[model samples]
Target: MSQAAADTMDNTHAAEHGGHHGEHHVLPYTVYFAVYGSLLVLTGITVLVSFAGLGKWSIPVAMAVAVVKASLVVGYFMHLKYDDRLNSLILVVTLLFILIFFAMTFSDMRTRGMIDPVEDNMVLRNEQAAEKAAAAEASGESSEKGEEAHHEGAAEH
Candidate 1:
Protein backbone atom coordinates (compact mmCIF):
# COMPACT_ATOMS: atom_id res chain seq x y z
CA MET A 1 0.00 0.00 0.00
CA SER A 2 1.12 3.62 -0.61
CA GLN A 3 2.39 5.79 2.34
CA ALA A 4 -0.75 7.98 2.27
CA ALA A 5 -3.02 4.90 2.33
CA ALA A 6 -0.96 3.41 5.22
CA ASP A 7 -1.34 6.62 7.26
CA THR A 8 -5.07 6.70 6.56
CA MET A 9 -5.42 3.06 7.66
CA ASP A 10 -3.60 3.78 11.00
CA ASN A 11 -5.88 6.73 11.68
CA THR A 12 -8.95 4.65 10.85
CA HIS A 13 -7.70 1.85 13.13
CA ALA A 14 -7.14 4.22 16.06
CA ALA A 15 -10.60 5.69 15.60
CA GLU A 16 -12.21 2.22 15.38
CA HIS A 17 -10.41 1.17 18.51
CA GLY A 18 -10.36 3.36 21.64
CA GLY A 19 -8.56 6.65 21.43
CA HIS A 20 -5.00 7.08 22.86
CA HIS A 21 -4.33 3.43 23.66
CA GLY A 22 -7.57 2.95 25.65
CA GLU A 23 -6.23 4.80 28.66
CA HIS A 24 -9.01 7.35 28.91
CA HIS A 25 -12.28 6.66 30.72
CA VAL A 26 -15.01 8.91 29.42
CA LEU A 27 -17.28 9.68 32.39
CA PRO A 28 -20.78 11.09 32.17
CA TYR A 29 -21.92 14.37 33.68
CA THR A 30 -24.06 12.61 36.24
CA VAL A 31 -21.09 10.78 37.69
CA TYR A 32 -19.22 14.03 38.20
CA PHE A 33 -22.26 15.69 39.80
CA ALA A 34 -22.72 12.76 42.13
CA VAL A 35 -19.11 12.92 43.27
CA TYR A 36 -19.40 16.67 43.79
CA GLY A 37 -22.55 16.25 45.86
CA SER A 38 -20.89 13.60 47.99
CA LEU A 39 -17.94 15.92 48.64
CA LEU A 40 -20.28 18.73 49.67
CA VAL A 41 -22.14 16.46 52.04
CA LEU A 42 -18.92 15.31 53.61
CA THR A 43 -17.84 18.92 54.09
CA GLY A 44 -21.11 19.71 55.85
CA ILE A 45 -20.62 16.70 58.07
CA THR A 46 -17.17 17.89 58.98
CA VAL A 47 -18.55 21.28 59.98
CA LEU A 48 -21.27 19.68 62.08
CA VAL A 49 -18.77 17.43 63.81
CA SER A 50 -16.68 20.46 64.69
CA PHE A 51 -19.69 22.09 66.37
CA ALA A 52 -20.78 18.76 67.88
CA GLY A 53 -17.97 19.03 70.47
CA LEU A 54 -16.01 15.89 69.62
CA GLY A 55 -13.10 17.53 71.52
CA LYS A 56 -9.98 15.38 71.03
CA TRP A 57 -11.70 13.36 68.32
CA SER A 58 -12.33 16.48 66.23
CA ILE A 59 -9.03 16.40 64.36
CA PRO A 60 -9.25 12.70 63.62
CA VAL A 61 -12.82 13.01 62.43
CA ALA A 62 -11.98 15.89 60.12
CA MET A 63 -8.99 14.01 58.75
CA ALA A 64 -11.11 10.95 58.07
CA VAL A 65 -13.69 12.95 56.16
CA ALA A 66 -10.96 14.74 54.22
CA VAL A 67 -9.42 11.43 53.21
CA VAL A 68 -12.74 10.21 51.89
CA LYS A 69 -13.21 13.37 49.88
CA ALA A 70 -9.69 13.04 48.49
CA SER A 71 -10.34 9.43 47.51
CA LEU A 72 -13.48 10.37 45.61
CA VAL A 73 -11.63 13.12 43.79
CA VAL A 74 -8.76 10.82 42.88
CA GLY A 75 -10.89 7.85 41.84
CA TYR A 76 -13.65 9.65 39.96
CA PHE A 77 -12.46 13.09 38.92
CA MET A 78 -8.91 12.02 38.21
CA HIS A 79 -10.06 8.67 36.81
CA LEU A 80 -7.47 6.74 38.80
CA LYS A 81 -10.00 3.96 39.40
CA TYR A 82 -10.06 3.18 35.66
CA ASP A 83 -6.35 3.88 35.38
CA ASP A 84 -3.46 1.43 35.27
CA ARG A 85 -2.80 -0.83 38.26
CA LEU A 86 0.72 0.51 38.57
CA ASN A 87 -0.55 4.05 39.01
CA SER A 88 -2.94 2.98 41.73
CA LEU A 89 -0.20 1.05 43.47
CA ILE A 90 2.02 4.10 43.45
CA LEU A 91 -0.68 6.18 45.12
CA VAL A 92 -1.25 3.55 47.83
CA VAL A 93 2.46 3.29 48.57
CA THR A 94 2.79 7.06 48.86
CA LEU A 95 -0.15 7.22 51.28
CA LEU A 96 1.31 4.42 53.38
CA PHE A 97 4.57 6.29 53.75
CA ILE A 98 2.73 9.46 54.75
CA LEU A 99 0.78 7.53 57.37
CA ILE A 100 3.97 6.12 58.82
CA PHE A 101 5.55 9.56 59.06
CA PHE A 102 2.55 11.04 60.88
CA ALA A 103 2.39 8.08 63.24
CA MET A 104 6.01 8.51 64.21
CA THR A 105 5.51 12.22 64.79
CA PHE A 106 2.51 11.74 67.09
CA SER A 107 4.24 8.94 68.97
CA ASP A 108 7.16 11.21 69.62
CA MET A 109 4.83 13.93 70.85
CA ARG A 110 3.14 11.54 73.28
CA THR A 111 6.37 10.12 74.66
CA ARG A 112 8.22 13.36 75.33
CA GLY A 113 8.17 13.23 79.16
CA MET A 114 9.50 9.66 79.38
CA ILE A 115 13.16 10.59 79.95
CA ASP A 116 12.39 13.42 82.40
CA PRO A 117 9.31 14.99 83.93
CA VAL A 118 7.92 17.94 81.99
CA GLU A 119 8.44 21.09 84.04
CA ASP A 120 5.95 23.24 82.15
CA ASN A 121 2.90 21.08 82.73
CA MET A 122 1.37 24.09 84.49
CA VAL A 123 -2.36 23.57 84.02
CA LEU A 124 -2.93 22.11 87.48
CA ARG A 125 -0.56 24.55 89.13
CA ASN A 126 -2.36 27.51 87.57
CA GLU A 127 -5.73 26.20 88.68
CA GLN A 128 -4.43 25.79 92.23
CA ALA A 129 -3.13 29.35 92.28
CA ALA A 130 -6.53 30.66 91.16
CA GLU A 131 -8.28 28.74 93.93
CA LYS A 132 -5.93 30.17 96.59
CA ALA A 133 -6.52 33.73 95.35
CA ALA A 134 -10.30 33.24 95.44
CA ALA A 135 -10.17 31.90 99.03
CA ALA A 136 -8.08 34.86 100.21
CA GLU A 137 -10.48 37.34 98.59
CA ALA A 138 -13.43 35.63 100.26
CA SER A 139 -11.90 36.00 103.77
CA GLY A 140 -11.01 39.66 103.07
CA GLU A 141 -14.60 40.32 102.02
CA SER A 142 -15.91 38.86 105.31
CA SER A 143 -13.60 41.15 107.41
CA GLU A 144 -14.75 44.17 105.37
CA LYS A 145 -18.37 43.28 106.06
CA GLY A 146 -17.63 43.07 109.84
CA GLU A 147 -16.01 46.54 109.81
CA GLU A 148 -18.99 47.97 107.94
CA ALA A 149 -21.37 46.52 110.55
CA HIS A 150 -19.29 47.94 113.45
CA HIS A 151 -19.32 51.42 111.86
CA GLU A 152 -23.12 51.29 111.46
CA GLY A 153 -23.65 50.28 115.13
CA ALA A 154 -21.47 53.17 116.42
CA ALA A 155 -23.35 55.65 114.24
CA GLU A 156 -26.72 54.39 115.57
CA HIS A 157 -25.51 54.95 119.18
Candidate 2:
Protein backbone atom coordinates (compact mmCIF):
# COMPACT_ATOMS: atom_id res chain seq x y z
CA MET A 1 0.00 0.00 0.00
CA SER A 2 1.09 3.58 -0.66
CA GLN A 3 2.46 5.54 2.39
CA ALA A 4 -0.46 8.04 2.33
CA ALA A 5 -3.01 5.27 1.90
CA ALA A 6 -1.47 3.23 4.74
CA ASP A 7 -1.50 6.20 7.11
CA THR A 8 -5.23 6.74 6.69
CA MET A 9 -6.30 3.60 8.53
CA ASP A 10 -6.89 3.69 12.33
CA ASN A 11 -8.14 0.21 13.06
CA THR A 12 -6.47 -2.72 14.79
CA HIS A 13 -5.42 -3.97 11.37
CA ALA A 14 -3.53 -0.74 10.83
CA ALA A 15 -2.09 -0.85 14.36
CA GLU A 16 -0.57 -4.25 13.61
CA HIS A 17 1.45 -2.59 10.84
CA GLY A 18 2.73 0.18 13.23
CA GLY A 19 0.44 2.70 11.52
CA HIS A 20 -1.53 5.05 13.78
CA HIS A 21 -1.02 2.52 16.53
CA GLY A 22 -1.41 4.94 19.41
CA GLU A 23 -3.76 7.57 17.99
CA HIS A 24 -7.14 6.16 17.16
CA HIS A 25 -8.45 9.33 15.55
CA VAL A 26 -6.80 12.50 14.30
CA LEU A 27 -9.19 15.36 13.56
CA PRO A 28 -7.98 18.57 12.00
CA TYR A 29 -7.69 21.86 13.87
CA THR A 30 -10.92 23.15 12.34
CA VAL A 31 -12.99 20.42 14.04
CA TYR A 32 -11.60 21.28 17.46
CA PHE A 33 -12.18 25.00 16.85
CA ALA A 34 -15.74 24.35 15.75
CA VAL A 35 -16.44 22.27 18.84
CA TYR A 36 -14.92 24.90 21.07
CA GLY A 37 -16.93 27.66 19.42
CA SER A 38 -20.12 25.65 19.86
CA LEU A 39 -19.38 25.17 23.56
CA LEU A 40 -18.86 28.90 23.98
CA VAL A 41 -22.10 29.69 22.19
CA LEU A 42 -23.99 27.23 24.34
CA THR A 43 -22.51 28.75 27.48
CA GLY A 44 -23.62 32.17 26.32
CA ILE A 45 -27.10 30.84 25.74
CA THR A 46 -27.14 29.39 29.28
CA VAL A 47 -26.20 32.76 30.75
CA LEU A 48 -28.76 34.61 28.68
CA VAL A 49 -31.50 32.18 29.65
CA SER A 50 -30.75 32.71 33.32
CA PHE A 51 -31.30 36.46 32.94
CA ALA A 52 -34.09 36.17 30.41
CA GLY A 53 -36.63 35.44 33.16
CA LEU A 54 -37.92 32.38 31.34
CA GLY A 55 -39.22 31.25 34.74
CA LYS A 56 -40.31 27.59 34.60
CA TRP A 57 -38.82 27.05 31.15
CA SER A 58 -35.33 28.18 32.13
CA ILE A 59 -34.27 24.94 33.74
CA PRO A 60 -35.28 22.82 30.74
CA VAL A 61 -33.71 25.28 28.32
CA ALA A 62 -30.44 25.39 30.23
CA MET A 63 -30.40 21.61 30.52
CA ALA A 64 -30.81 21.31 26.78
CA VAL A 65 -27.89 23.60 26.13
CA ALA A 66 -25.78 21.78 28.67
CA VAL A 67 -26.60 18.45 27.08
CA VAL A 68 -25.51 19.77 23.71
CA LYS A 69 -22.26 21.08 25.15
CA ALA A 70 -21.57 17.80 26.90
CA SER A 71 -22.31 15.88 23.70
CA LEU A 72 -19.83 17.97 21.74
CA VAL A 73 -17.13 17.52 24.37
CA VAL A 74 -17.73 13.79 24.62
CA GLY A 75 -17.98 13.22 20.87
CA TYR A 76 -15.02 15.31 19.73
CA PHE A 77 -12.66 15.84 22.64
CA MET A 78 -13.11 12.35 24.08
CA HIS A 79 -13.34 10.87 20.55
CA LEU A 80 -16.29 8.79 21.58
CA LYS A 81 -17.90 9.42 18.22
CA TYR A 82 -15.10 7.55 16.50
CA ASP A 83 -14.72 4.96 19.23
CA ASP A 84 -16.36 1.54 19.32
CA ARG A 85 -20.16 1.38 19.02
CA LEU A 86 -20.36 -0.60 22.26
CA ASN A 87 -18.63 2.19 24.13
CA SER A 88 -21.13 4.71 22.83
CA LEU A 89 -24.00 2.43 23.74
CA ILE A 90 -22.70 1.99 27.27
CA LEU A 91 -22.41 5.75 27.72
CA VAL A 92 -25.94 6.35 26.44
CA VAL A 93 -27.38 3.69 28.75
CA THR A 94 -25.58 5.12 31.75
CA LEU A 95 -26.88 8.59 31.02
CA LEU A 96 -30.41 7.29 30.61
CA PHE A 97 -30.23 5.64 34.04
CA ILE A 98 -29.03 8.84 35.61
CA LEU A 99 -31.84 10.81 33.99
CA ILE A 100 -34.36 8.28 35.27
CA PHE A 101 -32.95 8.51 38.78
CA PHE A 102 -33.19 12.30 38.86
CA ALA A 103 -36.70 12.26 37.45
CA MET A 104 -37.85 9.76 40.07
CA THR A 105 -36.23 11.71 42.89
CA PHE A 106 -37.89 14.95 41.79
CA SER A 107 -41.23 13.24 41.49
CA ASP A 108 -40.94 11.88 45.02
CA MET A 109 -39.93 15.28 46.35
CA ARG A 110 -42.91 16.99 44.72
CA THR A 111 -45.35 14.42 46.02
CA ARG A 112 -44.17 14.20 49.63
CA GLY A 113 -46.45 17.06 50.68
CA MET A 114 -49.44 15.40 49.05
CA ILE A 115 -48.64 12.13 50.82
CA ASP A 116 -48.74 13.80 54.24
CA PRO A 117 -49.62 17.48 54.18
CA VAL A 118 -49.58 18.15 57.94
CA GLU A 119 -46.17 16.61 58.45
CA ASP A 120 -44.42 17.02 55.13
CA ASN A 121 -45.70 20.56 54.48
CA MET A 122 -44.93 22.25 57.75
CA VAL A 123 -44.53 25.69 56.21
CA LEU A 124 -47.80 25.39 54.36
CA ARG A 125 -49.54 24.13 57.51
CA ASN A 126 -48.19 27.02 59.52
CA GLU A 127 -49.28 29.54 56.91
CA GLN A 128 -52.78 28.03 56.94
CA ALA A 129 -52.93 28.26 60.72
CA ALA A 130 -51.82 31.88 60.61
CA GLU A 131 -54.48 32.69 58.08
CA LYS A 132 -57.12 31.15 60.35
CA ALA A 133 -55.86 33.18 63.28
CA ALA A 134 -55.99 36.37 61.23
CA ALA A 135 -59.52 35.62 60.06
CA ALA A 136 -60.63 35.04 63.65
CA GLU A 137 -59.13 38.33 64.72
CA ALA A 138 -60.69 40.20 61.81
CA SER A 139 -64.15 38.75 62.63
CA GLY A 140 -63.99 40.40 66.08
CA GLU A 141 -63.52 37.06 67.86
CA SER A 142 -61.80 37.38 71.22
CA SER A 143 -58.03 36.63 71.17
CA GLU A 144 -58.60 34.55 74.28
CA LYS A 145 -61.00 32.34 72.33
CA GLY A 146 -58.28 31.61 69.80
CA GLU A 147 -55.75 30.99 72.57
CA GLU A 148 -58.12 28.70 74.41
CA ALA A 149 -58.79 26.74 71.23
CA HIS A 150 -55.11 26.39 70.61
CA HIS A 151 -54.46 25.28 74.18
CA GLU A 152 -57.41 22.90 74.10
CA GLY A 153 -56.07 21.24 70.93
CA ALA A 154 -52.61 21.00 72.50
CA ALA A 155 -54.16 19.48 75.59
CA GLU A 156 -55.99 16.86 73.48
CA HIS A 157 -52.58 15.75 72.27
lDDT, candidate 1, equals: 0.75
Q: Any residue pairs clashing in model 1, and if so which?
A: none
**Reference-based TM-score of each model:** 0.59, 0.59
Question: How would you encode candidate 2's per-residue C-alpha lDDT over 24-53 as one tens digit per residue?
Answer: 566666778878998998899899889999
Residue-level lDDT of model 1, residues 48-116, one tens digit each, is 999999889999999999999999999878867656666788999998999999999999887664433
Point out where model 2 deviates above 4 Å: 1-23, 117-157
Q: Which candidate is the best by lDDT?
A: 2
Worst 10 residues of 2 by lDDT: 1-10
After TM-score superposition, the amount by which residue 47's alpha carbon in candidate 1 deviates from its true location, in angstroms, is 1.2
45: Cα error in model 2, Å: 1.7
